[model samples]
Target: METPSTSTSSYQRDDGPVRATLVGIGLTVFGLLMANVLTTPAFLFDPALLEGLGNGSIAGRTLALILNFVGMFLAGLLYLLATGRGLAWIDLRIPSRRDWKYIVAGGVGSLVFLFAFNIVTTLLEVSAAESQIMEIIGGDQTMILIMIVVVFLFNAPAEEFLFRNVIQKRLYAAFTRMQAVVVASVIFALVHFPMYVAFADSLLSTLASLTVMFGGALIFGYVYAKTDNLLVPTAAHAVLNAFQFTVLYLAIEYGIEEVQAEPATLAEVADAVWTVAVALA
Candidate 1:
């Protein structure tokens, strides 16, 4: 029987619920600060250095993304060492046959949650805010391609490693599984507030955006709790993101939806892609 990659904890945690929660939060903050610091150089960034990276035109963007991911990765590694844990403490493994069932459910469940959330928001007359990540991608074929790769390699793995394996796991020391999932989800949702706030029309919109993010966190958290393999949620998150970019690319590329609007429909997105394929063929 093969086990996931993990290490036995040298276990010295003495903090109570409140203090322990704070520790997890501090790690999140540290990661963000470090990522920002690492990415700052991209502001005056010249693309010439990595001119032929992901795409020549998006060289600077690619560099910034790499730095940002590196910063977050380093933060997690440093914290792991500081806590007397090793790299192996982060649990990752190949998905077993049963694990794939949960992974697929996680991805499909997320989409369903999103659909239901959109309906509720509309029913409540809550105006939605533009997603910062989507706005950045903005239906650009090149940017979307870059993001598809980054989301799989860096974004999903780094975020899941920190929030799920590190933060959520730490909370288990002082809280129940449900409590830990909720707390970690709250942190996950709140961290996205800055991005949402920028495009928010009002407080309601910001809150709405956070609600969706919170729900997403919950979905991802639920999968981690069920599977216990960090790679499961990472794969689920990355697949959802990849599907979104592909759908969104088709939606906007064919004028089926505007760049700034939420995708109108998946059926339409697929239809557009088929149309293009046939035309090209």
Candidate 2:
């Protein structure tokens, strides 16, 4: 398929595959460090700052999320400045009704991909890694509700802007749309390696998480490549995350057990089905 937007700069047009891949990896690594690594300093800077901000505390989660948001954009800004690029490179725009079609497709596709991947890992005797968000919010209904907006307003936008808009787009200089998307997706997934290491119980579980994240990243990259609209992937990402949190919130409200990212999850599968049905309608 022809990509709607092509890299137009002389540098973009002239870069070779090896250079593009290396630079893409570098940018992704830098972005990850900014968002994830910088998070540790909160405790080091002042232990008092962490008084009410740990794990299940709303204050802690919110602060971490806010810092994450700032970190992503901070790295992106520096990258743009150092590379002589502009904000236009990471095109952020309001979606039209037409764009919404791609957004919904991307969102539904991501959910379905995640469910299927988890199921496959289970069959292979490896459980998928649960999202850290589940650990953060726990049974706090207020935090669950807060996450719905945070993922959309802060997390999704920051991540999509750095990963999809910048990192994935950078690969366009040397790769086809599909190839670029795949490569970028891998990088995006690996960026979460540390989280998996911290949260996953075994190597297989960590791999499963990386695999599932890579698949979801593929959807994010493809929709952005197709529409050349950053918002498509951003909204899709927000939908994917918010969907999980919403499910947990509802489960808690109904006094159900804590949800985990496991195979054959009836709630997720059912909700995804409903999403597809509505999308198709």
Candidate 3:
């Protein structure tokens, strides 16, 4: 369970859980604030831009997604610099062949977890909150492809860097490894509550969705702890997202007729799938 933080002599003393929690919260807020400040002008000024930036439009959603990545990244970078650590401390090095095993295991584990959780939710009649969010971000084929690329390249890496590399590592110094994992995972799950709130119909369903996300975050944190390679968890996160998106794409392309009496357009289906994946991730 030794991380680069554990191995390095130059690492700073743990700031304790309270400070870590405060810093993590601060970073999240700062990122959101920055995104709002940066995107609001463009969102307001241009008519065509306004249309593109509509809630369900590809351009609008993509802009939001990119702003999220930028905000988290800048915040993480500032945190590291303030703490006297550099980018190297985050361990962005490419995973080795052995590390790849953990990455693959994480991906497989996520799929298994999601499958089991979905079955249980289905039995209990709990809806997937992400699906509703997807319906709001309607897009066409070109937009879908662009969304996939952005998600795979920017969103996955930026999120892993912020959560696993920075937040989890800092928390690890203040708590037992298991405690750190639980706490970090809780934060991770909680951060997603806004999306769930926007789309979930009932409290129980929202709780169920968060519970599944918490489980996934636990797996991600564990893999990062074990391997000490950010890429391992990032790969896993990307794979999980890719799998989910692929399934949605296939469902939209092939099963739409079977599922709906008058099927939605392929673009609409793609939009729904992409938006859901974005929210869930």
Candidate 4:
């Protein structure tokens, strides 16, 4: 119901957006680098010791997911320490009833945005990066289950802690709430672009994927701002991601492939643009 205590005796009010931006950007870059190194198939497994752990294998995916989770958490913790803040600043407590409302709103908002984005992209003949991600999910039911758990428990919290709690909160000291929200959301969306680029066959598809991400990040930022609870946004994020993976799992199980979009007529493209504008409004 109330905002968490962000106060600290060691916290410096003068350390504003400049410090926040540097620390946020630095930790993100560092975390990605560490994740890549830690998840490298050659580094994690010896060819002779683990001949079956190829880059595309379930073992590799699991390892990479786990390592990436660890790397992000470590990076966040380090950022907190470096900034003279503590875990208390992150507001990782149980959500209050009001917080739950915000969480549900955030989750539903995300789903709505997702459906709208999907419709627009489908009309525009944009292929989804999710197809490639689903391929990585593969047909292994057990691995898929494990992935859902990891994403819900680890990835969601870790990302929310870093972006919303640390980065956005710090940015608040230097900018208006809306400005902080936009900047933080932009960073959040931009960081995910590499994955889309890796999977998308064309730049247009990658941009479309990033557009959806940006919209989702905007909603997440808005929720955190409104509720002032990290757990709310984190829970919402977890729910959204888990639901997505769940749908993917069911699709894979039932052999329902992603729908390929037909080439858009000029009118369809204009209509799709109008729809997006209306949705944004």
Q: All candidates' TM-scores? A: 0.83, 0.82, 0.81, 0.80
Leading candidate by TM-score: 1
Clashing pairs in 1: none
Off by over 4 Å in 2: 1-12, 36-56, 258-281
lDDT, each prediction:
0.73, 0.72, 0.67, 0.67
Error of 4 at 181 (Å): 1.4
**Shift in Å, residue 29, candidate 3:** 2.3
Lowest lDDT 10-residue stretch of candidate 3 = 259-268
Question: Top lDDT: which candidate number?
Answer: 1
Give me the runs in candidate 4 sitting further than 4 Å from their true place: 5-19, 40-43, 46-57, 130-132, 259-281
Kindly report the root-mean-square deviation of model 3 from the true structure over all alpha carbons.
6.0
Our tally of clashes for model 2 stands at 1
* Predicted candidate 1 versus true structure: per-residue lDDT over 1-281, tens digit per residue: 11432222332345599987898889999999989888767645764434323333466777777788778877888898898877766777778887898899988888777667666765788766766555455457788788889989998888888898888877877777678889999999899788778777899888877887787788888888766788888998898778767766665566654433654222122333445455445
lDDT of 3: 0.67
lDDT of 2 by residue, 195-277 (tens): 77877788887887787778888888888887878889999999888877676665555554433233112224444344444
For TM-score, candidate 3 versus 4, the one ahead is 3
User: Where in model 3 is the C-alpha error above 4 Å?
Assistant: 1-13, 41-60, 131-136, 255-281
